[model samples]
Target chain A: MHTEAGPKRPTTPVQKGLQAIPLIINVISANFQLNQFSSLTLLEFALDSSVLLLVGGNRGRCVWATPMNNIIAYLFKSSLGKKYIMAVTGCCLFLFVIGHMVGNLQVFLGPEAINRYGHFLQSNPELIWPARIGLLVFVGLHFWSAMQITLENRAARPVAYANSKPVAASYASRTMVMGGLIVVSFIIYHLLHFTFQCKAINLTGQDFVGFTDPNNHHDIFKMIVVGFNQPLVAGFYLLSMGLLCLHLSHGLSSMFQSLGWKNDAYRPIIDCGAKVVATVIFIGYSSIPVAILVFKFGKEALK
Target chain B: MNLTLKVWRQKNGQTEGHFETYPARDIIEDMSFLEMLDVVNEGLISSGKDPIAFDSDCREGICGMCSLVINGIPHGGHAGTATCQLHMRRFKDGETITIEPWRAKAFPIIKDVATNRSAFDRIIQAGGFVSVNTGGTPDGNALPISKEVSDRAMDAAACIGCGACVAACKNASAMLFVAAKVSHLNLLPQGEPEKHRRALAMVTQMDKEGFGSCTVTGSCEAVCPKEIKLTFIAKLNRDFGVAALLGK
Candidate 1:
């Protein structure tokens, strides 16, 4: 019976220790070579693979059990677990969007004020790089779990209703996926236009990356003024902002509900509160494009 | 009143179902929706044809046995009403009505417009209970539940398990039903001991049964015969989160 067990799995504790030596070396080497391979990710991968090995250990083929493994299973495999992932990641992205809007609004503070803010952010690789990576991870998790849940939802009801009509669901709630997709497209374009400083897409026929201010800092204010001067770029920016706000209108309160922070007594407040915040964000972000393209706030500084 | 019904017809669970139209002539305005179907079935039986199979029990609306997705809305789109309670007068004379079963992967069609809802029973068995030994009746004020808590619990307990919430959801999610059941048991003093375990077990069972996840669309609450609040789902979420955190 002992010999019949598969050799792939390390059966005894001594065998497991022997197997772990190679894994430890792999983890260290991976950490040194792959800059993106964070220690936490490697540990998680190790835990996941160990679970697979234990379950496939050629005994009963039973699922490996542990508190941590249970937590992992609950988070990834269960419906509620997936929803929790969406909720947590959504909250992160929501905060990032607000911070981004606030950062963009620094443009209205004039050249020195906005340029200082931009330079400060750019100067801190330690602060900015981690943030960028974290944001990317959150976005990936949010979008992936969303697609998974949406596909499961679609499959749940294989037959289509002939004449279905909305009863209590709001328009924003119903169109989240569409709005999310549009906002994602907008993120790609926005990053290309501003962060990457790709002049070809900016439509202004001008290089933005090397332009320097009087203080020898990156002329972010000038870049913004020039970038938004193009009608098509500004229009797309404004459209994406609109879609982002629409996504937030339902998403903000729904986050609370999914996390179990909401109840009937505060239901009305949460609902209206979400809408009010969404509207405020919309106005705040939209002000940038409208000011640039219509009011021409920073055009004088550009010259 | 004369009405045209495009009803789903299937011989059994394995067969393909289709919409078979039948003229429901001279239906009394006072007749309930199920009663109208009964009359239609009488016609089919008299004409030597197969009668439409549907579920109805205690037409008084309390039992939650009747289910029909009429005109694309569960329970005929009436607010806080079940199919057995929906009167024919709610529909216009000469209007066309479309009827279908609770189309969900979890609730398979057993026959024409009738589905297997034992998925719910399994979920309930997974947790929805308070364990106790057989004994004499306990004192009414033994635990001293607050009036507010009892009222809230009663509101959740009002769900008749009609599966309208499932039918109305675009995703065919059973979040509302599970939420209602979880909340009804979770809020009481007697249930506090097993609260976390109940949430984890019931939610696990619900997912195992192939029901979809909640999107907080509010459609489920709107079609609920008991008018179960969406807050219960939030409460379930909270309870589940707490339970999972506790690893119960």
Candidate 2:
């Protein structure tokens, strides 16, 4: 549809047939910036059309547009809409946390293994870049919805009771905001310590980017080993893990409730399962720092 | 028994409120909390002073008219009890007591310990009803509702709308109240036809009323005079999600 001449642009009959669809044409013509049209991948094209279908009204005068607009209004401007967003994003972040913990656990497999895995991920920009952007969007939406809910909650109770007392809400459930804020702070510090390889914040007085494994990949093994070898660093890591545990303990089950996946029959199981999973995650994550700091598992490799 | 009372004294919604201390003398242990208040207010009126004002109806627990936060606990923190049902025997003699109104932006305080809870009526008016034909009462057996379904509906229908759940919730959320109202109708055959519209409209009206969203904190259920379960909120969430996704 664009005037740009690029090899990546679709030329085959099937792709041309797919482009013949009027809705995609409408979305491309109506919404996207002029430059973005040339580089639109199949995934981007599908995602944009669906979003436009829901938001911009169907085909400019389609019969389904009214209900779609109402649904969009409900999702965007209502209390339950904010809740649905939080629960969905919270689920995404929860899955990411599990994946990250599994990836970090690979450090136990020794230098070559973990470094190779890191290299594989780092080298794939096409895959990693999209995943990274999706993750950033999820995090942003999660935190933004949380902030809106928190502020609205505060405004709902403008007058304070003289002697308010909590009856059944757990401490972890009550302190979600506080723990979430701390976890966010830890995420920033963690990205700097490892992902960015910023030496000044690592407190080791040595830059981590220069370190290389025998095969010349970035030595994630050595960086993690040296980083957590310091008691203060490991201690902070442990503390953040504890907060993460607290956050997940309530969040996991609460996510189910918010999404309407929870019911009275499954309440006990969901609640118990959440705590168990949270504890398992804590143990899995904390083991790495403890091994590096206390057991000196990888200290010999540093020399 | 004699007790010192520190009660919230507000002239009206537009004026500032404060605590005015008074001695509650010769209160019998068998008297209800409202009876004790009545005695105290009598003394104030005898002295030609402004008496404490609060809300109460049916002096029994079922009307859901009584709203008070005693010592920071809604409905005196008694399980399955409204403020009217809270007896003086629950308190110790020669002790100090604190009483406040149901505190929430939506349930604005009209006077001392009394609030304007008509916001709830407006919410119910939004979509809490099913369209029925005007006729003589239909035979109950016409709708073959199974025992389990009817019982479940009854459980949700137990909500008294006392506003205690709102008072007990830190966020002053009306989720439990809305959930109960929505579920009782949604589960029944009569309410099935309007289910999607009811869920969508009631929640929209609830948000419009400025109530906070549910944080899944069990505080509302804990202090609910009718002991409405927190699971109903999940039911509402589930229903709302389906209706919204289906564009109903």
Best by TM-score: 1
**Candidate 2 clashing pairs, residues 3+ apart or interchain:** A163-B72
In candidate 1 chain A, where is summed lDDT lowest over 10 consecutive residues? A60-69
Off by over 4 Å in 1: A1-45, A48-69
- lDDT tens string, model 2, B8-112? 999999999999899999999999999999999999999999989988879989999988889888888888988888899999999999999988999998999
List candidate 2 stretches off by more than 4 Å: A1-69, B134-137
Candidate 2: tens digits of C-alpha lDDT, residues A192-286: 99988888899889899999988989999999998998788899899999999999999999999999988889999999999999999999999
Global lDDT of each candidate: 0.85, 0.86
Instruction: State the weakest 10-residue window (summed lDDT) of model 2 chain A.
Output: A59-68
Fnat for the candidates in order: 0.81, 0.84
Q: What DockQ does each candidate score versus the true complex, computed on alpha carbons?
A: 0.72, 0.67
